[model samples]
Target: ATGGRYVPRAILMDLEPGTMDSVRAGPFGQLFRPDNFVFGQSGAGNNWAKGHYTEGAELIDSVLDVVRKEAEGCDCLQGFQMCHSLGGGTGSGMGTLLISKVREEYPDRIMETFSVIPSPKVSDTVVEPYNAVLSFHQLVENADECFLLDNEALYDICFRTLKLTTPTYGDLNHLVSAAMSGVTTCLRFPGQLNCDLRKIAVNLVPFPRLH
Candidate 1:
């Protein structure tokens, strides 16, 4: 674990070519290995169907290999957790594809997801609702539990609570990161109320589809 936190062995996948290089140069670059990054032919250009049927299928094997390796290294492999936006092509389409494949390959392992749903008032993509519906179906079918993050709610929190008149992407990301950290604090830090992923699912998800 890095800095007393369980730093996951991750395999970052994207549809845009050369996007991995920019990600690798970021602050979290040291957390990932060069081989753990996978990219498709090019950007999906907000085409969810293209990401799911074409690029997602093509890169399945490579992504699974990395997942298998990470699971093998774990002393007690518990489950999988995925984070993505439901309005984007790669994040929604490819993310759903990966979740389905993971469920197929590892039937016993639990899968949880943190999905960002687009705000109707602020969504940029015309087909975002279509992408969201498709991805939500896959999440219900494959993931054992899901945490929904609404863009409008988060935007409101930034504007009203945090007093950010014009919140940038970085500010929004920081908010999301903070929420994630708070939810996982029991797993990361030792305390009286020690909670695992299973417990989290039990408490948060009363019904699989509702989650």
Candidate 2:
């Protein structure tokens, strides 16, 4: 959650560095910290411009550079897990960039991504859902599987929870917690898997691979 040193292989790379720090201090530290994932103007050569929507599209090569090196170095990170919002602006652009770069690094690694897209009436930002949806489809083509969280579908739940003023951060956190729980649960309880996922993810392992 809050580590100055070794970050867990699992971290969500969303939000700005400043905001991520606040999220860490806010008690959701374990899930939304910087060390766990990388994105958003972290380094100068991050292959992104300062603008919003363009940043994601700008960093495809940069993301892959980091991922390839990272996966090669760590045994725990055989596969890379990434996240981006399909909501608008940075999420889709950046998510697409990261995913494109990932597919290029076709070693033994598998790239898993989670994205949330904006609803039509959400605001002016909603206009790009078409492009986001398209990019999401392309990513699905390369990824093992793609999971989509639709904002329109979620609005009813948010409205029902008295979050009409705006969606509460707590609600968002719960959603993330649930998604993660679902994945782990699908695999079964700790140390108890419902299936043997032991097939050598040769791509995930640094090659020459050991599957």
Candidate 3:
């Protein structure tokens, strides 16, 4: 997933341990470092591993509206390059609903998504499997592309390459950030990418087939 044919960027909600100062920064930058993440114990017990979920539809919806407004506000922008969505639960589920509104708002602007599917270990749980398949399917219907990342396979790469002693939260976030950086660099650097937005839309494919 690190060395893909194209690169991508993100517009995340939070940034830099998230104090009051940096609310609603542009989609361009974030800490994206392992150190900034919060580690917590799940509600069931006080230790092992537990992932939490929220009914964040309203929040996601509002955020998408903000992004659409910003995209429209771009003075130099003739037309949008693409709208990116996430194929995962928060990204896909929340993302799908948001893009629909965006399409209504800006009919011709391109919308794309960079989402990850759950790994078998994570997918063994009911929530991830359900979210991944259902959300991803919906995303494929509307988004320009769903660049899939298998957490399991990616983690294996991190462990092997980074030589992490324990696959701690820090290690995991680093891997995710690195992969994102790789994508961003590839697409934005000109000539580095084998394909661009035109190729993807015209052919409906990820060309250059970087694997």
Listed in order, each prediction's TM-score against the native is 0.90, 0.62, 0.58
Per-candidate local distance difference test:
0.84, 0.53, 0.46
Q: Which is the leading candidate under TM-score?
A: 1
lDDT of 3 by residue, 56-165 (tens): 33354545655655566566432332322232343445445555566677666655555666666744344555555555555555555445666677668767877765
Residue 210 of model 3 has an lDDT of 28
Count clashing residue pairs per candidate: 0, 9, 9
After TM-score superposition, the amount by which residue 115's alpha carbon in candidate 3 deviates from its true location, in angstroms, is 1.3
TM-score of 2: 0.62
Q: Which candidate order results from sorting by TM-score in descending order? A: 1, 2, 3
What is the model-wide C-alpha lDDT for candidate 2?
0.53
- For residues 1-211, what per-residue lDDT tens digits would candidate 2 score against the true structure? 2355545544444424665567577754755335445556643222223222354445444555556555776755435555666544455655665566666765445565666655666544535656566565656555554555666666667787646757765676577668756754634554434322222222233432221
lDDT of 3 at 88: 34
Using lDDT as the measure, the top candidate is 1
